[model samples]
Target: MTSIPWLTILVFLPLVGALLCLLSWHSAALCRWLALATSWGVFTLTAGLFAAFRQGGAGWLLYEDHAWIAPLGIRYTLGLDGISLLLVLLTGFLMVVAVLVSWRVTRFSAAYFALLLGMEAGILGVFLALDLVLFYLFWELMLIPMLFLIGIWGHAGRAPAAVKFFLFTLAGSLLMLIAIIGLHLVHVEAGGAPSFALEALRGTALPARVEPWLYAAFLLAFALKVPLLPLHTWLPDAHTEAPTAGSVILAGLLLKTGVYGLLRFGLPLFPNAAAASLPWLAVPALVGIFYAAWIAYVQTDAKRLVAYASVAHMGFVVLGLAAWNQTALEGSILQLLSHGITTAALFALVGMIDERAHTRRLDELGGLWGRVPRLGFFFLLFCLAALGLPGLNNFVGEIMILIGAFQTRPWWGAAAFVGVVFAAAYMLRLVQAVLWGPPRRRDFWPDLDVREGVVLVALALAALWIGLYPAPLLQPLQAPVADLLGQVPLGPGPGGVP
Candidate 1:
């Protein structure tokens, strides 16, 4: 164990920045610089952690534990496995991007930056925390800042969108809280020490009768965050109404938390339950893939279209997780990272376009290639990535997912293959409408500014890096994912258990 508490520093650094931003509420420039510098510092620290990280080492790294509420057996514990380290890096990277993109937010600037930093802190903590209570606190802590971001700084319909987002997430969280407490109670009842420690709880076997219900509670909370299928209505509205930075964070970081929770907590904690629920979960994931794609095809609002595309993309992630094999799970994690980079870039592009054009409707956006070639080119690159073009980040993850899903169930793979086709169709349509169609307005639209180009290029480079060389990313995930799969008993052949 390193004596320095690197994980604690990583988690709390953003909170410290937010406090500074709050203190300098009158100076927007100082606030922006503080938030940006803080975010970049966090990213730099994360890179250091990654450099020190040993691939295929023990499942948890940089472990930190401290007594808290000793009478109730609650402890403040934080650690990172390969899966979490990747997410922490993603969170830090996106926080920098969010700060950069929000450079234009002049309304209540200090509060806005403060909330953004606070949200980043919460997200980092959620990825790092090892105790159930600590995890839940970080989880709920994310909600308040996000709610304020949407409600205070978003478009005209922001109020309702924020409320819907809150209610859906809150309801799901309450269920998870019940499950968390119930799991601890089960530990106590089983004559074990009562603890909210995840590893400890994972060892407590509940009665088969109660396991399914408890698993369902956790699943519902995560699914809503994933916003899988029927539980996904709030996502489009929230994404469409939120400000650019808000949408970027929501798409890039928040959505992944759902999938992460499932892999980190839900599956291992209730292996049998997760195994049995695979088929049931697979159906909704498959449904979300096609349904969201179809909806995206008909959307006029460009932002809303991207929002729907997120649903379809995340559907692949859920399906991959349900497969519960090393290949599929690793692909699912890659998809989480790739989707975050690609989707956040797309949302950022849309925001930039909207800022200039004062509109996001596809009908109003055409022939941008002539006006803003730089912007159009980057948009095209991310679009190709989003559609899973070969040699792009999205392709690697999607192909691995399909192959893994096939190994589990031929039809599951086939259906997901069809979703890929749907993805290409809708994404191309979006491309054609926004970039190649006849000009809608004769007014000159400027290409990306230096700052904007830097943001898009950085994101594109990440996508390109992942696309060409994924071995480093894949290697780290192997042990953690294999550990997760080992928890679920397998049959002689594929798809035998479910």
Candidate 2:
């Protein structure tokens, strides 16, 4: 309805940037600057959209729909509500961070930036698309660039790790594709016009018996991406093998797509089935917290430890979704936005240390505070946030999630606290081992350079702002969440995250 094709432009701008990067592949410096400028432009555009966005709306603030294939009822549709808008903003912001973090990338540098931009476009497409077919297309779009990133730029075991990530995700995507087709066919058979439009297909009078199966299909796909419990084996490897930028996007954005899928499509399309599956889904989500944390604590490799920490953090997100209350969902979204900042910061720091020390092994790292005090200080800040320290970003989300869980089921709240304890244990141990003891090697490592400082400061500031006052973010969330609850309400409460 709006005049501008803002959503469409937002979706493809990164892609155009990607193409430009490819065209200039011979000029690494040109590619770097181009990627930086393109990413900043996207972030600026997205920020403008956010600022101009109307509050108190329950539907898309901006929407674009044009026929892609009329006979098949597929259309190029994108919807931006509060949820999609926040995530899109995240995609834009993190693309900037990803580029900045990759500033030092020399080998295949142009291709690397292109792939990052390509991945950005794909991720934006996923967040914006409203047509089932269109969404699926975007889903597939993101996969290839990420696959090559790990395979080409990653560490020693990149090949198998990349393969594992691809296969697991592809397996999930196939199921989701089948479910998409099945839903469209059902709508067609029920005397409705053939359409993959989410708005039209939602509440398709799916047979009660068939609903669970379809819902399960969607859940399996999302869960695998959520990497919930037993299905999560591929994630640690992917995280460990990936480059710094890869790890950032994998943790910050890609994993979020899973929960976003469930929030945007699966639950709304099959509300009854989603309600029924809550307890079952909760099992893995709740358990993954402690399980991953325990494993993280035992890891000697610092990078692998943070990799497992991502698993544990994702467990919190899934559990919040399982609670299905406003506070919990808000917390989950907060965790999504804030965790993207804090965790990405952690991975960036780890990468920085590895760059200097030539090792990510805990035993080989020590007394960094004596050498790079600023670096150690920032590392400590994000680590504290990750551990859910009060007055920090992670705490706000966790507390809200816990409150929401408590309202739904007291035991769920109590059990989740155990994971918080484990977080402190692991994070504290990391801080102590890395910053307190004598240097493992006598050679001095460089402190934060201008580029690294800018990125870390950006992340740190966001974390502090969210922790200090999340009201701005929380306020606009109500109307859309209320709309979602109208479709599938989990527990009784006020509309906002509080």
Query: What is the C-alpha local distance difference test score of each model?
Result: 0.91, 0.89
Off by over 4 Å in 2: 54-56, 490-498
RMSD after CA superposition, every candidate: 1.6, 2.1
Model 1 bad stretches (over 4 Å): 492-498
lDDT of 1 by residue, 343-407 (tens): 99999999999988999999999998888999999999999999999999999999999888888
Q: Write the per-residue lDDT of candidate 2 for residues 64-119, one digit (tens) a residue.
A: 88999999999999888888878888888888999999998989888999999988
Q: How many pairs in model 1 have backbone atoms within 3 A of each other, for residues 3 or more apart or on separate chains, i.e. clashes? A: 0
Give model 1's TM-score versus the native structure: 0.98
Q: How many backbone clashes does candidate 2 have?
A: 0
Model 2 TM-score (2 dp): 0.97
Clashes of each: 0, 0
Ten-residue stretch with the least lDDT total in model 1: 489-498
Per-model TM against the reference: 0.98, 0.97
